[model samples]
Target: MSIKSATPYFLLNGRTEQAIALYQRALGAKTESLQRFGDVDGSCPTAMRNRVMHAMLRVGNAVLMMSDGPEDVKLPEGGNVSVALDFETPAALRQSVEALAATGKVLERVFEAPWGALFGVVQDEFGIQWMVTSPLK
Candidate 1:
């Protein structure tokens, strides 16, 4: 068996662009690729022509894949899966948390744990949950 790379993929109904912009601003993520439904030939509804058909974002070395499609059934609170971002500095960690928390909720504000690490959880505006962490210097 051969596995070259693994990435987290998100399916957000009518919100992929918003989520992509949030990550790009908060995590220093770069847009690797984007293909809108409009790019497809008659595959999507004209109402959803501007919707995201596919997108790839690079945060550090991690690649995030996503698309805006049909709305999903509401979970208890979105879902159980969480995307975590580990950082090497306090500034980086803080910046990310603040960015993701914009128009969102901070489940756990950044704080020092007994293990001498900073940790927190935030659900982005799109209801996607995330864990942010950093080691104390």
Candidate 2:
């Protein structure tokens, strides 16, 4: 069997909406579809009914899937996973870095890397790490 596509799925606790807004602003992400827990046939808990059950976003050529995970689960502050974004132009990369940094912590400022590329790292408010980079000109 051949794999069709691989997408990054984020379990945002109860902040999926906030993350969605941030991605829209920082990465020009568009929500292709979203389903709320309330959409289910009255099986969801009252508190979680308003939360997002699933959302599909299109960022550039990639698709990002996310959800407000079950209430019992708690995500740690930082994890081993990081989302790496590669841009075609330095300007685009810089723009995304600034936007993400506005509401997030900049672990590394954008700079020329030894590998001949511009790179930086930021941890968003939701604790999701991002590595932003662009190829050398």
Which candidate tops TM-score?
2
Model 2 lDDT tens row, 23-50: 9999999999999988974887798888
lDDT of 2 at 46: 90
Query: What are the lDDT scores of the predictions, listed in order?
Result: 0.83, 0.89
Q: Return model 2's CA RMSD, one decimal.
A: 1.4
User: 57, model 1: CA deviation in Å?
Assistant: 0.2
What TM-score fits each model? 0.86, 0.92
lDDT of 1 by residue, 48-135 (tens): 7787889999999788998886544432434678988889998899988888888799999889977789999999887788888899
Candidate 2 Cα deviation (angstroms), residue 36: 0.9
The total number of steric clashes, by the backbone 3 Å criterion, in model 2 comes to: 0
lDDT of 2: 0.89
Cα displacement (Å) at residue 93, model 1: 0.3
| Residue 29, candidate 1: alpha-carbon lDDT | 85
